[model samples]
Target: MNVNRRLNVSEVGDVTVVRFVDRRILDEANIQEMGQELFQLVEEQGKKQILLNFAGVEFLSSAALGKLITLDKRVKSHSGKLILSNIRPEIYEVFKITRLNTTLDIKDDEADALAAFAALQAT
Candidate 1:
């Protein structure tokens, strides 16, 4: 497991789960750093299965959302999977409003997200 200032990265089985440490992911620099770290996990570390846990994140700026979208595309381009879990209702609503809910795979909890990954690997 690795802990960055804004992200707590750990492994669950074959999946890398990154949990946000900040309550509000609103800063552009922080958002950019998070995106780079996630991309590194996929591009450099070869961790294609990623689960982003949003339990601590209460607010996110549009910039943060943009970063997430880019990360999602990067993972997909690698023929990998990205999932989000434990999202606050307010944050989930933002994804829904932005129509990202259709494009992203979101789960209710860490267990569910991990199980989804396991299922994917089995098939």
Candidate 2:
């Protein structure tokens, strides 16, 4: 992984946590590429649920949002889910306005997000 890249990825149990540590998603030109990277990483690792932590992200473009939608679909196709965690109030409102929050599992915190995934996996 590129050191300067905004995303820091790791696995926690059956879930893969992709934390955005930077304020931005970095290169707009590589949004799709980055999205594919994330998808492939989870798929290759056989991770069912994913926690996309956006706590450090201050802004995200529509392109990034589109990529997230793509990722959500990919995860669901495998009978899994993508959960958005630690979304700031402002960014949460953006997702709300766009109605992505309704489609994606949007959690207020990491603990709740992980618990939700674990509970789902238990079923």
Per-residue lDDT of 107 in model 2: 90
lDDT of 1 by residue, 1-119 (tens): 44467778888889999998778999888888888888888888888999999987889988998999999999999999999999989999999999999999999999999999999
Cα RMSD (angstroms) for every candidate in the order listed: 1.5, 2.3
Overlapping backbone residue pairs in candidate 1 total 0
Which residue runs of candidate 1 sit more than 4 Å off their true CA positions? 1-3
Show pairs that collide, candidate 1.
none
Model 2 error, position 102 (Å): 0.9
Span of ten consecutive residues with least summed lDDT in model 2: 1-10
- The TM-score leader among the candidates is 1
TM-score of each: 0.95, 0.87
Q: Encode model 2's per-residue lDDT on 1-123: one tens digit a residue.
A: 334244678888878888865577656766766786677755776667789888878888888888899888888888878899998898888898999888988998889999998888788
Model 1 TM-score?
0.95
